[model samples]
Target: MRKLVMVSMLIGLGVLPACTRTTNTMGYIVDEVLVAEVKPGIDNRASVEKALGKPSIAGQWDDKTWYYVSRNTKQTAFLMPKPTEQSIIAVSFDAKGNVASVNRRGLEQVANVDPVNDKTPTLGRETGVLEDLFGNIGRFGSAGSAGGPPQ
Candidate 1:
Protein backbone atom coordinates (compact mmCIF):
# COMPACT_ATOMS: atom_id res chain seq x y z
CA MET A 1 0.00 0.00 0.00
CA ARG A 2 2.86 2.37 0.78
CA LYS A 3 4.41 1.73 -2.60
CA LEU A 4 1.11 2.43 -4.36
CA VAL A 5 0.77 5.70 -2.49
CA MET A 6 4.32 6.67 -3.35
CA VAL A 7 3.81 5.92 -7.02
CA SER A 8 0.64 7.98 -7.09
CA MET A 9 2.39 10.82 -5.33
CA LEU A 10 5.18 10.76 -7.87
CA ILE A 11 2.73 10.82 -10.75
CA GLY A 12 0.78 13.68 -9.20
CA LEU A 13 3.97 15.61 -8.59
CA GLY A 14 4.99 15.19 -12.19
CA VAL A 15 1.59 16.37 -13.39
CA LEU A 16 1.44 19.39 -11.15
CA PRO A 17 3.99 21.37 -13.18
CA ALA A 18 1.92 21.01 -16.35
CA CYS A 19 -1.00 22.89 -14.82
CA THR A 20 0.54 26.34 -15.29
CA ARG A 21 0.34 28.27 -18.57
CA THR A 22 4.05 29.17 -18.44
CA THR A 23 3.36 32.86 -18.80
CA ASN A 24 5.16 35.62 -16.95
CA THR A 25 3.06 37.35 -14.30
CA MET A 26 4.98 40.55 -14.92
CA GLY A 27 3.23 40.74 -18.32
CA TYR A 28 0.32 42.30 -16.46
CA ILE A 29 2.42 45.36 -15.82
CA VAL A 30 0.97 48.38 -17.64
CA ASP A 31 4.13 50.36 -18.37
CA GLU A 32 5.95 47.22 -19.53
CA VAL A 33 3.67 47.25 -22.55
CA LEU A 34 5.45 48.12 -25.81
CA VAL A 35 3.90 50.79 -28.01
CA ALA A 36 5.34 51.81 -31.34
CA GLU A 37 6.35 55.42 -31.68
CA VAL A 38 4.51 57.42 -34.29
CA LYS A 39 6.32 60.04 -36.30
CA PRO A 40 3.90 62.87 -36.99
CA GLY A 41 3.16 63.53 -40.68
CA ILE A 42 5.77 60.99 -41.79
CA ASP A 43 4.42 57.45 -41.31
CA ASN A 44 1.84 56.67 -43.97
CA ARG A 45 -0.54 53.75 -44.49
CA ALA A 46 2.00 51.54 -46.26
CA SER A 47 4.71 52.35 -43.72
CA VAL A 48 2.32 51.83 -40.84
CA GLU A 49 1.23 48.45 -42.16
CA LYS A 50 4.82 47.38 -42.71
CA ALA A 51 5.77 48.19 -39.11
CA LEU A 52 2.63 47.13 -37.22
CA GLY A 53 1.05 44.51 -39.48
CA LYS A 54 -2.76 44.64 -39.29
CA PRO A 55 -4.68 46.46 -36.59
CA SER A 56 -7.21 44.88 -34.29
CA ILE A 57 -9.60 47.61 -35.35
CA ALA A 58 -9.69 50.38 -37.98
CA GLY A 59 -12.19 53.06 -38.94
CA GLN A 60 -12.91 56.75 -39.35
CA TRP A 61 -15.57 59.00 -37.80
CA ASP A 62 -15.08 62.55 -39.07
CA ASP A 63 -12.67 62.49 -41.99
CA LYS A 64 -10.44 60.34 -44.17
CA THR A 65 -7.89 58.40 -42.07
CA TRP A 66 -6.55 54.92 -41.33
CA TYR A 67 -5.85 53.20 -37.99
CA TYR A 68 -3.80 50.17 -37.01
CA VAL A 69 -3.68 48.31 -33.71
CA SER A 70 -1.78 45.39 -32.17
CA ARG A 71 -2.13 43.26 -29.06
CA ASN A 72 0.10 40.72 -27.26
CA THR A 73 -0.77 38.64 -24.23
CA LYS A 74 0.55 36.14 -21.68
CA GLN A 75 -1.38 34.31 -18.98
CA THR A 76 -0.63 32.08 -16.01
CA ALA A 77 -2.45 29.50 -13.95
CA PHE A 78 -4.15 29.42 -10.55
CA LEU A 79 -3.33 32.16 -8.01
CA MET A 80 -0.13 33.23 -9.78
CA PRO A 81 -1.53 36.01 -11.99
CA LYS A 82 -3.32 36.90 -15.21
CA PRO A 83 -0.86 38.68 -17.46
CA THR A 84 -2.00 40.59 -20.54
CA GLU A 85 -0.43 43.29 -22.75
CA GLN A 86 -1.84 45.22 -25.67
CA SER A 87 -1.23 48.36 -27.76
CA ILE A 88 -3.27 50.45 -30.16
CA ILE A 89 -1.68 52.50 -32.92
CA ALA A 90 -3.82 55.07 -34.64
CA VAL A 91 -2.60 56.38 -38.00
CA SER A 92 -4.68 59.17 -39.32
CA PHE A 93 -4.43 60.75 -42.74
CA ASP A 94 -5.87 63.65 -44.66
CA ALA A 95 -7.82 63.30 -47.92
CA LYS A 96 -4.46 63.57 -49.62
CA GLY A 97 -3.31 60.33 -47.89
CA ASN A 98 -0.65 62.17 -45.88
CA VAL A 99 -0.29 61.19 -42.25
CA ALA A 100 -2.27 63.59 -40.08
CA SER A 101 -1.82 62.67 -36.42
CA VAL A 102 -0.96 59.50 -34.55
CA ASN A 103 -2.86 58.53 -31.43
CA ARG A 104 -1.27 55.84 -29.35
CA ARG A 105 -3.14 54.55 -26.28
CA GLY A 106 -2.30 51.96 -23.67
CA LEU A 107 -4.82 49.72 -21.95
CA GLU A 108 -4.43 51.76 -18.76
CA GLN A 109 -4.58 55.07 -20.59
CA VAL A 110 -7.94 54.18 -22.15
CA ALA A 111 -10.99 55.22 -20.18
CA ASN A 112 -13.54 52.67 -19.10
CA VAL A 113 -16.80 54.04 -20.51
CA ASP A 114 -18.83 51.46 -18.58
CA PRO A 115 -20.43 50.46 -21.91
CA VAL A 116 -22.60 53.59 -21.67
CA ASN A 117 -24.88 51.53 -19.40
CA ASP A 118 -26.70 50.61 -22.59
CA LYS A 119 -27.87 47.29 -21.23
CA THR A 120 -28.22 48.44 -17.67
CA PRO A 121 -27.34 45.69 -15.26
CA THR A 122 -30.58 44.26 -14.00
CA LEU A 123 -31.35 44.96 -10.37
CA GLY A 124 -32.57 41.90 -8.42
CA ARG A 125 -33.01 40.13 -11.72
CA GLU A 126 -32.79 36.37 -11.86
CA THR A 127 -29.07 35.76 -12.23
CA GLY A 128 -28.94 32.32 -10.69
CA VAL A 129 -27.64 29.58 -12.97
CA LEU A 130 -30.34 27.18 -11.82
CA GLU A 131 -33.11 29.67 -12.55
CA ASP A 132 -32.01 30.08 -16.15
CA LEU A 133 -31.84 26.34 -16.55
CA PHE A 134 -35.63 26.09 -16.33
CA GLY A 135 -36.61 29.53 -17.64
CA ASN A 136 -38.15 30.18 -21.05
CA ILE A 137 -35.82 29.02 -23.79
CA GLY A 138 -37.35 31.01 -26.66
CA ARG A 139 -37.23 34.42 -25.02
CA PHE A 140 -34.39 33.90 -22.58
CA GLY A 141 -31.42 31.72 -23.46
CA SER A 142 -31.13 28.15 -22.23
CA ALA A 143 -30.06 28.26 -18.58
CA GLY A 144 -27.01 26.12 -19.38
CA SER A 145 -27.67 23.50 -16.74
CA ALA A 146 -28.03 19.76 -16.45
CA GLY A 147 -31.58 18.45 -17.04
CA GLY A 148 -32.73 21.88 -18.23
CA PRO A 149 -36.20 22.27 -19.81
CA PRO A 150 -36.68 20.50 -23.13
CA GLN A 151 -36.21 22.40 -26.38
Candidate 2:
Protein backbone atom coordinates (compact mmCIF):
# COMPACT_ATOMS: atom_id res chain seq x y z
CA MET A 1 0.00 0.00 0.00
CA ARG A 2 2.87 2.38 0.75
CA LYS A 3 4.44 1.70 -2.66
CA LEU A 4 1.17 2.39 -4.41
CA VAL A 5 0.82 5.77 -2.65
CA MET A 6 4.44 6.65 -3.53
CA VAL A 7 3.88 5.88 -7.20
CA SER A 8 0.75 8.02 -7.31
CA MET A 9 2.60 10.89 -5.64
CA LEU A 10 5.40 10.58 -8.19
CA ILE A 11 2.91 10.72 -11.05
CA GLY A 12 1.25 13.80 -9.59
CA LEU A 13 4.61 15.52 -9.27
CA GLY A 14 5.36 14.86 -12.92
CA VAL A 15 2.02 16.28 -14.04
CA LEU A 16 2.36 19.50 -11.99
CA PRO A 17 4.77 21.10 -14.45
CA ALA A 18 2.19 20.88 -17.23
CA CYS A 19 -0.02 23.43 -15.45
CA THR A 20 2.62 26.19 -15.46
CA ARG A 21 2.05 29.46 -17.26
CA THR A 22 2.09 29.28 -21.04
CA THR A 23 3.55 31.87 -23.43
CA ASN A 24 1.69 32.70 -26.63
CA THR A 25 2.82 34.64 -29.67
CA MET A 26 0.02 36.72 -31.11
CA GLY A 27 -0.23 38.81 -34.32
CA TYR A 28 2.45 39.12 -37.00
CA ILE A 29 5.68 37.13 -36.76
CA VAL A 30 8.33 39.59 -37.93
CA ASP A 31 11.43 38.47 -39.83
CA GLU A 32 14.39 40.82 -39.43
CA VAL A 33 15.84 39.97 -42.82
CA LEU A 34 12.65 40.76 -44.68
CA VAL A 35 12.08 43.93 -42.66
CA ALA A 36 15.61 45.10 -43.44
CA GLU A 37 14.97 44.74 -47.16
CA VAL A 38 12.14 47.29 -47.06
CA LYS A 39 13.81 50.60 -47.95
CA PRO A 40 12.14 53.96 -48.10
CA GLY A 41 11.89 55.56 -51.57
CA ILE A 42 12.35 52.12 -53.14
CA ASP A 43 9.65 49.80 -51.84
CA ASN A 44 6.07 50.56 -52.77
CA ARG A 45 2.87 49.24 -51.25
CA ALA A 46 2.96 46.17 -53.45
CA SER A 47 6.63 45.43 -52.70
CA VAL A 48 6.16 45.92 -48.97
CA GLU A 49 3.19 43.58 -48.97
CA LYS A 50 5.23 40.94 -50.77
CA ALA A 51 8.08 41.29 -48.32
CA LEU A 52 6.17 41.49 -45.04
CA GLY A 53 2.80 40.03 -46.01
CA LYS A 54 -0.35 41.86 -44.89
CA PRO A 55 0.08 44.29 -42.02
CA SER A 56 -1.54 43.56 -38.67
CA ILE A 57 -3.43 46.84 -38.89
CA ALA A 58 -3.48 49.99 -40.98
CA GLY A 59 -4.21 53.65 -40.35
CA GLN A 60 -7.82 53.97 -39.31
CA TRP A 61 -8.48 57.14 -41.30
CA ASP A 62 -6.52 56.26 -44.42
CA ASP A 63 -4.42 53.54 -46.07
CA LYS A 64 -1.26 55.68 -46.17
CA THR A 65 0.22 54.01 -43.10
CA TRP A 66 0.58 50.35 -42.22
CA TYR A 67 1.65 48.68 -39.00
CA TYR A 68 3.08 45.23 -38.34
CA VAL A 69 2.58 44.34 -34.70
CA SER A 70 3.86 41.35 -32.75
CA ARG A 71 3.33 40.49 -29.13
CA ASN A 72 4.20 37.71 -26.68
CA THR A 73 1.85 37.13 -23.80
CA LYS A 74 1.94 34.82 -20.80
CA GLN A 75 -1.11 33.52 -19.01
CA THR A 76 -1.63 31.19 -16.06
CA ALA A 77 -4.71 29.02 -15.92
CA PHE A 78 -7.81 31.24 -16.27
CA LEU A 79 -6.06 34.59 -15.70
CA MET A 80 -5.93 37.32 -18.30
CA PRO A 81 -2.94 37.20 -20.60
CA LYS A 82 -0.24 39.74 -19.82
CA PRO A 83 2.10 41.08 -22.44
CA THR A 84 5.68 39.85 -22.12
CA GLU A 85 7.06 41.54 -25.21
CA GLN A 86 5.68 43.75 -27.94
CA SER A 87 7.01 45.16 -31.21
CA ILE A 88 5.51 47.45 -33.79
CA ILE A 89 6.80 48.38 -37.21
CA ALA A 90 5.11 51.36 -38.77
CA VAL A 91 5.60 52.00 -42.48
CA SER A 92 4.36 55.21 -43.94
CA PHE A 93 3.74 55.80 -47.62
CA ASP A 94 4.05 58.92 -49.65
CA ALA A 95 1.22 60.24 -51.80
CA LYS A 96 2.66 58.39 -54.77
CA GLY A 97 2.56 55.02 -52.92
CA ASN A 98 6.31 54.71 -52.24
CA VAL A 99 7.55 54.05 -48.75
CA ALA A 100 8.17 57.35 -46.98
CA SER A 101 9.49 56.15 -43.64
CA VAL A 102 9.85 53.09 -41.46
CA ASN A 103 9.68 53.31 -37.68
CA ARG A 104 10.15 50.64 -35.03
CA ARG A 105 8.56 50.77 -31.58
CA GLY A 106 8.65 48.52 -28.53
CA LEU A 107 6.67 47.83 -25.38
CA GLU A 108 7.11 51.34 -23.98
CA GLN A 109 4.28 52.61 -26.18
CA VAL A 110 1.67 50.32 -24.65
CA ALA A 111 -1.09 52.06 -22.69
CA ASN A 112 -3.02 50.61 -19.77
CA VAL A 113 -6.62 51.67 -19.84
CA ASP A 114 -9.10 50.98 -17.05
CA PRO A 115 -12.65 51.80 -17.99
CA VAL A 116 -14.95 53.66 -15.61
CA ASN A 117 -17.24 51.30 -13.74
CA ASP A 118 -20.81 51.59 -12.32
CA LYS A 119 -23.57 53.59 -13.93
CA THR A 120 -22.64 55.83 -16.83
CA PRO A 121 -23.62 59.45 -16.20
CA THR A 122 -26.20 60.73 -18.63
CA LEU A 123 -28.18 63.96 -19.06
CA GLY A 124 -31.37 62.98 -17.31
CA ARG A 125 -33.14 63.22 -13.95
CA GLU A 126 -32.38 60.40 -11.53
CA THR A 127 -35.27 58.10 -10.54
CA GLY A 128 -35.78 55.23 -8.14
CA VAL A 129 -36.33 51.60 -9.19
CA LEU A 130 -40.11 51.83 -8.40
CA GLU A 131 -40.39 54.98 -10.50
CA ASP A 132 -38.71 53.26 -13.46
CA LEU A 133 -41.09 50.30 -13.19
CA PHE A 134 -44.22 52.44 -13.28
CA GLY A 135 -42.98 55.65 -14.99
CA ASN A 136 -44.84 54.99 -18.28
CA ILE A 137 -48.19 54.42 -16.57
CA GLY A 138 -50.96 56.88 -17.63
CA ARG A 139 -48.55 58.45 -20.17
CA PHE A 140 -50.82 57.66 -23.11
CA GLY A 141 -54.23 59.37 -23.56
CA SER A 142 -57.45 57.29 -23.52
CA ALA A 143 -58.85 56.36 -26.98
CA GLY A 144 -62.14 58.23 -26.23
CA SER A 145 -60.32 61.34 -24.94
CA ALA A 146 -59.47 62.55 -28.45
CA GLY A 147 -63.20 63.22 -28.93
CA GLY A 148 -63.92 63.33 -32.71
CA PRO A 149 -60.61 63.91 -34.51
CA PRO A 150 -60.33 66.96 -36.82
CA GLN A 151 -63.64 68.80 -37.40
Candidate 3:
Protein backbone atom coordinates (compact mmCIF):
# COMPACT_ATOMS: atom_id res chain seq x y z
CA MET A 1 0.00 0.00 0.00
CA ARG A 2 2.81 2.44 0.90
CA LYS A 3 4.68 1.73 -2.34
CA LEU A 4 1.51 2.21 -4.43
CA VAL A 5 0.65 5.55 -2.72
CA MET A 6 4.23 6.81 -3.18
CA VAL A 7 4.23 5.89 -6.91
CA SER A 8 0.86 7.60 -7.44
CA MET A 9 2.02 10.78 -5.66
CA LEU A 10 5.19 10.97 -7.79
CA ILE A 11 3.21 10.48 -10.99
CA GLY A 12 0.75 13.21 -9.99
CA LEU A 13 3.58 15.60 -9.20
CA GLY A 14 5.19 14.92 -12.58
CA VAL A 15 1.96 15.76 -14.39
CA LEU A 16 1.57 19.07 -12.56
CA PRO A 17 4.61 20.69 -14.24
CA ALA A 18 3.39 19.75 -17.72
CA CYS A 19 0.02 21.28 -16.98
CA THR A 20 1.46 24.54 -15.62
CA ARG A 21 4.18 25.05 -18.21
CA THR A 22 3.19 27.97 -20.48
CA THR A 23 5.05 30.06 -23.00
CA ASN A 24 4.99 33.87 -22.65
CA THR A 25 4.29 35.30 -26.12
CA MET A 26 6.82 38.10 -26.46
CA GLY A 27 5.67 39.54 -29.79
CA TYR A 28 3.15 42.05 -31.10
CA ILE A 29 0.95 42.02 -34.18
CA VAL A 30 1.36 44.76 -36.77
CA ASP A 31 -1.73 44.40 -38.90
CA GLU A 32 -2.24 45.87 -42.38
CA VAL A 33 -2.39 49.42 -41.12
CA LEU A 34 -2.05 52.24 -43.65
CA VAL A 35 1.61 53.13 -43.97
CA ALA A 36 1.36 56.60 -45.51
CA GLU A 37 -2.06 57.87 -46.37
CA VAL A 38 -1.09 61.35 -47.46
CA LYS A 39 -0.70 62.04 -51.20
CA PRO A 40 2.93 61.86 -52.18
CA GLY A 41 3.16 65.34 -53.74
CA ILE A 42 -0.14 67.07 -53.02
CA ASP A 43 -1.16 66.30 -49.44
CA ASN A 44 -1.08 69.22 -47.00
CA ARG A 45 -1.67 69.23 -43.24
CA ALA A 46 -5.43 68.95 -43.43
CA SER A 47 -5.31 66.46 -46.30
CA VAL A 48 -2.86 64.21 -44.46
CA GLU A 49 -5.01 64.07 -41.34
CA LYS A 50 -8.02 63.23 -43.50
CA ALA A 51 -6.32 60.18 -45.08
CA LEU A 52 -4.41 58.50 -42.23
CA GLY A 53 -5.21 58.04 -38.57
CA LYS A 54 -3.35 59.94 -35.84
CA PRO A 55 0.40 59.49 -35.96
CA SER A 56 2.45 57.79 -33.28
CA ILE A 57 5.02 60.58 -33.64
CA ALA A 58 4.69 63.86 -35.50
CA GLY A 59 6.78 66.98 -35.43
CA GLN A 60 8.59 69.41 -37.68
CA TRP A 61 12.26 70.14 -38.20
CA ASP A 62 13.42 71.80 -41.43
CA ASP A 63 10.83 69.43 -42.82
CA LYS A 64 7.80 67.75 -41.24
CA THR A 65 7.79 64.02 -40.42
CA TRP A 66 5.01 61.74 -39.31
CA TYR A 67 5.65 58.29 -37.89
CA TYR A 68 3.18 55.45 -37.42
CA VAL A 69 4.33 52.41 -35.49
CA SER A 70 2.88 49.16 -34.15
CA ARG A 71 4.45 46.43 -32.05
CA ASN A 72 3.65 43.27 -30.08
CA THR A 73 6.12 41.99 -27.49
CA LYS A 74 6.51 39.29 -24.89
CA GLN A 75 9.20 38.82 -22.25
CA THR A 76 8.95 35.26 -21.02
CA ALA A 77 12.42 34.62 -19.62
CA PHE A 78 15.39 36.68 -18.47
CA LEU A 79 16.29 40.11 -19.81
CA MET A 80 15.62 40.28 -23.59
CA PRO A 81 14.61 36.67 -23.83
CA LYS A 82 11.61 37.07 -26.09
CA PRO A 83 11.17 38.45 -29.61
CA THR A 84 9.26 41.39 -31.04
CA GLU A 85 7.51 42.10 -34.32
CA GLN A 86 7.31 45.75 -35.26
CA SER A 87 6.70 48.15 -38.13
CA ILE A 88 7.38 51.84 -38.70
CA ILE A 89 5.78 54.06 -41.29
CA ALA A 90 7.32 57.44 -41.95
CA VAL A 91 6.07 60.32 -44.09
CA SER A 92 8.02 63.48 -44.81
CA PHE A 93 6.69 66.80 -46.02
CA ASP A 94 8.47 69.60 -47.89
CA ALA A 95 8.57 73.22 -46.69
CA LYS A 96 5.27 73.86 -48.40
CA GLY A 97 3.74 70.86 -46.56
CA ASN A 98 3.56 68.61 -49.63
CA VAL A 99 4.43 64.99 -48.90
CA ALA A 100 8.01 64.48 -50.02
CA SER A 101 8.88 60.94 -48.95
CA VAL A 102 7.04 57.91 -47.67
CA ASN A 103 9.15 55.11 -46.30
CA ARG A 104 8.21 51.79 -44.74
CA ARG A 105 10.46 50.11 -42.21
CA GLY A 106 10.16 46.50 -41.14
CA LEU A 107 12.00 44.79 -38.34
CA GLU A 108 14.59 43.22 -40.64
CA GLN A 109 15.44 46.52 -42.38
CA VAL A 110 15.63 48.87 -39.40
CA ALA A 111 18.74 49.79 -37.45
CA ASN A 112 19.14 51.59 -34.14
CA VAL A 113 21.17 54.80 -34.56
CA ASP A 114 23.00 56.88 -31.97
CA PRO A 115 22.05 60.56 -32.11
CA VAL A 116 25.71 61.59 -31.86
CA ASN A 117 28.38 59.70 -33.77
CA ASP A 118 31.47 59.53 -31.56
CA LYS A 119 34.33 58.99 -33.99
CA THR A 120 38.02 58.77 -33.10
CA PRO A 121 40.27 61.13 -35.05
CA THR A 122 42.99 59.67 -37.27
CA LEU A 123 45.75 61.17 -35.05
CA GLY A 124 44.78 58.58 -32.45
CA ARG A 125 44.90 58.83 -28.64
CA GLU A 126 47.57 57.43 -26.29
CA THR A 127 47.80 53.62 -26.29
CA GLY A 128 47.97 52.58 -22.63
CA VAL A 129 45.26 53.24 -20.01
CA LEU A 130 47.80 54.83 -17.61
CA GLU A 131 49.02 57.14 -20.36
CA ASP A 132 45.50 58.24 -21.23
CA LEU A 133 44.61 58.86 -17.57
CA PHE A 134 47.90 60.61 -16.58
CA GLY A 135 48.82 63.01 -19.40
CA ASN A 136 51.54 62.09 -21.94
CA ILE A 137 54.08 59.25 -21.90
CA GLY A 138 56.89 61.84 -21.37
CA ARG A 139 55.28 63.00 -18.13
CA PHE A 140 57.17 60.23 -16.26
CA GLY A 141 60.49 61.89 -17.22
CA SER A 142 59.44 65.10 -15.46
CA ALA A 143 58.96 63.33 -12.12
CA GLY A 144 62.08 64.93 -10.52
CA SER A 145 60.91 68.31 -11.79
CA ALA A 146 61.34 72.00 -10.93
CA GLY A 147 63.96 72.18 -13.77
CA GLY A 148 66.40 70.29 -11.57
CA PRO A 149 69.43 68.41 -12.99
CA PRO A 150 68.94 64.79 -13.97
CA GLN A 151 70.07 62.02 -11.57
Candidate 4:
Protein backbone atom coordinates (compact mmCIF):
# COMPACT_ATOMS: atom_id res chain seq x y z
CA MET A 1 0.00 0.00 0.00
CA ARG A 2 2.88 2.38 0.86
CA LYS A 3 4.71 1.65 -2.39
CA LEU A 4 1.51 2.17 -4.40
CA VAL A 5 0.87 5.52 -2.74
CA MET A 6 4.46 6.66 -3.35
CA VAL A 7 4.25 5.72 -7.02
CA SER A 8 0.91 7.51 -7.38
CA MET A 9 2.32 10.66 -5.74
CA LEU A 10 5.37 10.65 -8.01
CA ILE A 11 3.17 10.23 -11.11
CA GLY A 12 0.91 13.02 -9.97
CA LEU A 13 3.85 15.34 -9.45
CA GLY A 14 5.22 14.57 -12.91
CA VAL A 15 1.83 15.16 -14.58
CA LEU A 16 1.06 18.40 -12.73
CA PRO A 17 3.68 20.49 -14.56
CA ALA A 18 2.71 19.03 -17.95
CA CYS A 19 -1.00 19.69 -17.40
CA THR A 20 -0.41 23.35 -16.51
CA ARG A 21 -1.50 25.78 -19.21
CA THR A 22 -0.07 29.29 -19.27
CA THR A 23 -2.15 31.99 -20.95
CA ASN A 24 -0.69 35.27 -22.21
CA THR A 25 -2.68 38.32 -23.28
CA MET A 26 -1.13 41.25 -25.06
CA GLY A 27 -2.25 44.77 -26.13
CA TYR A 28 -5.68 46.24 -25.50
CA ILE A 29 -8.46 44.65 -23.51
CA VAL A 30 -11.79 45.37 -25.22
CA ASP A 31 -15.23 45.43 -23.71
CA GLU A 32 -18.25 44.99 -25.96
CA VAL A 33 -20.29 47.33 -23.79
CA LEU A 34 -17.81 50.17 -24.18
CA VAL A 35 -17.32 49.51 -27.89
CA ALA A 36 -21.01 49.88 -28.54
CA GLU A 37 -20.89 53.40 -27.17
CA VAL A 38 -18.67 54.60 -30.01
CA LYS A 39 -20.49 55.87 -33.08
CA PRO A 40 -18.82 56.56 -36.38
CA GLY A 41 -19.21 59.93 -38.19
CA ILE A 42 -20.03 61.43 -34.79
CA ASP A 43 -17.31 60.42 -32.36
CA ASN A 44 -14.21 62.54 -32.82
CA ARG A 45 -10.67 61.62 -31.82
CA ALA A 46 -11.08 63.15 -28.38
CA SER A 47 -14.34 61.32 -27.73
CA VAL A 48 -12.90 58.11 -29.05
CA GLU A 49 -9.90 58.50 -26.81
CA LYS A 50 -12.18 59.20 -23.88
CA ALA A 51 -14.35 56.16 -24.55
CA LEU A 52 -11.65 53.60 -25.45
CA GLY A 53 -8.76 55.21 -23.55
CA LYS A 54 -5.94 54.90 -26.13
CA PRO A 55 -5.26 52.75 -29.17
CA SER A 56 -2.50 50.19 -29.35
CA ILE A 57 -1.06 51.69 -32.51
CA ALA A 58 -1.65 54.68 -34.72
CA GLY A 59 -1.04 55.14 -38.44
CA GLN A 60 2.63 55.43 -39.25
CA TRP A 61 2.38 58.22 -41.83
CA ASP A 62 -0.68 59.91 -40.37
CA ASP A 63 -2.85 59.86 -37.28
CA LYS A 64 -6.03 59.24 -39.27
CA THR A 65 -6.14 55.56 -38.30
CA TRP A 66 -6.00 53.85 -34.92
CA TYR A 67 -5.67 50.17 -34.12
CA TYR A 68 -6.56 48.35 -30.95
CA VAL A 69 -4.97 44.92 -31.17
CA SER A 70 -5.37 42.07 -28.72
CA ARG A 71 -4.17 38.49 -28.78
CA ASN A 72 -4.58 35.60 -26.35
CA THR A 73 -2.10 32.73 -26.50
CA LYS A 74 -1.84 29.57 -24.43
CA GLN A 75 1.09 27.24 -23.91
CA THR A 76 1.41 24.00 -22.02
CA ALA A 77 4.77 23.32 -20.37
CA PHE A 78 7.65 24.14 -22.70
CA LEU A 79 5.62 24.19 -25.93
CA MET A 80 5.46 27.29 -28.09
CA PRO A 81 2.48 29.53 -27.42
CA LYS A 82 -0.39 29.35 -29.91
CA PRO A 83 -2.87 32.08 -30.42
CA THR A 84 -6.27 30.99 -29.16
CA GLU A 85 -8.02 34.28 -29.80
CA GLN A 86 -7.16 37.52 -31.57
CA SER A 87 -9.04 40.78 -31.98
CA ILE A 88 -8.25 43.97 -33.86
CA ILE A 89 -10.41 47.05 -33.64
CA ALA A 90 -9.64 49.51 -36.40
CA VAL A 91 -10.96 53.03 -36.21
CA SER A 92 -10.41 55.55 -38.97
CA PHE A 93 -10.99 59.27 -38.95
CA ASP A 94 -11.60 61.75 -41.71
CA ALA A 95 -9.79 65.09 -42.08
CA LYS A 96 -12.20 66.67 -39.63
CA GLY A 97 -11.14 64.11 -36.98
CA ASN A 98 -14.57 62.52 -36.79
CA VAL A 99 -14.67 58.74 -36.82
CA ALA A 100 -15.21 57.64 -40.41
CA SER A 101 -15.25 53.91 -39.90
CA VAL A 102 -15.10 51.38 -37.09
CA ASN A 103 -14.12 47.86 -38.05
CA ARG A 104 -13.42 44.73 -36.02
CA ARG A 105 -11.53 41.60 -37.04
CA GLY A 106 -10.83 38.20 -35.50
CA LEU A 107 -8.34 35.38 -35.72
CA GLU A 108 -9.48 34.55 -39.28
CA GLN A 109 -7.79 37.72 -40.50
CA VAL A 110 -4.44 36.92 -38.88
CA ALA A 111 -1.66 36.36 -41.43
CA ASN A 112 1.20 33.96 -40.87
CA VAL A 113 4.33 35.97 -41.66
CA ASP A 114 7.24 33.70 -42.50
CA PRO A 115 10.47 35.70 -42.27
CA VAL A 116 13.05 35.33 -45.04
CA ASN A 117 15.44 32.47 -44.23
CA ASP A 118 18.17 33.41 -46.73
CA LYS A 119 21.05 35.54 -45.51
CA THR A 120 21.64 38.97 -47.01
CA PRO A 121 24.09 38.98 -49.95
CA THR A 122 27.04 41.17 -49.10
CA LEU A 123 29.12 43.02 -51.68
CA GLY A 124 32.59 41.90 -50.57
CA ARG A 125 34.07 38.45 -51.26
CA GLU A 126 33.94 35.95 -48.39
CA THR A 127 37.31 35.25 -46.80
CA GLY A 128 38.27 31.89 -45.22
CA VAL A 129 39.40 31.47 -41.57
CA LEU A 130 43.14 31.23 -42.42
CA GLU A 131 42.94 34.27 -44.74
CA ASP A 132 41.28 36.32 -42.00
CA LEU A 133 43.95 35.34 -39.43
CA PHE A 134 47.03 35.92 -41.70
CA GLY A 135 45.64 38.39 -44.26
CA ASN A 136 47.05 41.56 -42.53
CA ILE A 137 50.41 40.04 -41.51
CA GLY A 138 52.59 41.46 -44.33
CA ARG A 139 50.55 44.59 -45.14
CA PHE A 140 52.33 47.08 -42.76
CA GLY A 141 55.88 45.58 -42.87
CA SER A 142 57.86 44.61 -39.67
CA ALA A 143 56.52 45.95 -36.31
CA GLY A 144 59.81 47.66 -35.22
CA SER A 145 60.47 49.50 -38.51
CA ALA A 146 58.82 52.95 -38.21
CA GLY A 147 59.32 56.15 -40.27
CA GLY A 148 63.09 56.57 -39.44
CA PRO A 149 64.13 55.43 -35.86
CA PRO A 150 61.88 55.44 -32.75
CA GLN A 151 62.29 58.71 -30.72
Candidate whose lDDT is highest: 2
TM-score for candidate 3: 0.47
Go through the candidates in order and give each one's C-alpha lDDT.
Answer: 0.57, 0.93, 0.63, 0.90
Enumerate clash totals for all models, in the order shown.
Answer: 2, 0, 6, 0
Off by over 4 Å in 1: 24-38, 60-65, 77-81, 109-151
Q: Which residue window of length 10 is worst by lDDT in model 2?
A: 142-151
Question: If candidate 1 were superposed on the true structure by all CA atoms, what would the RMSD be?
Answer: 11.0
Tell me the TM-score of each prediction against the true structure: 0.49, 0.69, 0.47, 0.68
lDDT of 2 by residue, 34-116 (tens): 99999999999999999999999999999999999999999986788888899999999999999999999999988886667
Judged by lDDT relative to the true structure, which candidate is superior, 1 or 2?
2
Q: List where candidate 4 sits over 4 angstroms from the true fold.
A: 1-15, 114-151
User: How close is each model in CA RMSD to the real structure?
Assistant: 11.0, 7.0, 10.3, 8.0
Q: How good is model 1 by TM-score?
A: 0.49
Between prediction 1 and prediction 2, the one with superior TM-score is 2
Look at candidate 3 and give me any clashing residue pairs.
26-74, 27-72, 27-73, 27-74, 28-72, 28-73
Q: Encode model 4's per-residue lDDT on 16-117: one tens digit a residue.
A: 987799999998999988888889878999999999989999999999999999999999989878899999999999999999999999999877866576
Choose 2 or 3, whichever is better by TM-score. Answer: 2
Candidate rank order under lDDT: 2, 4, 3, 1
TM-score of 2: 0.69
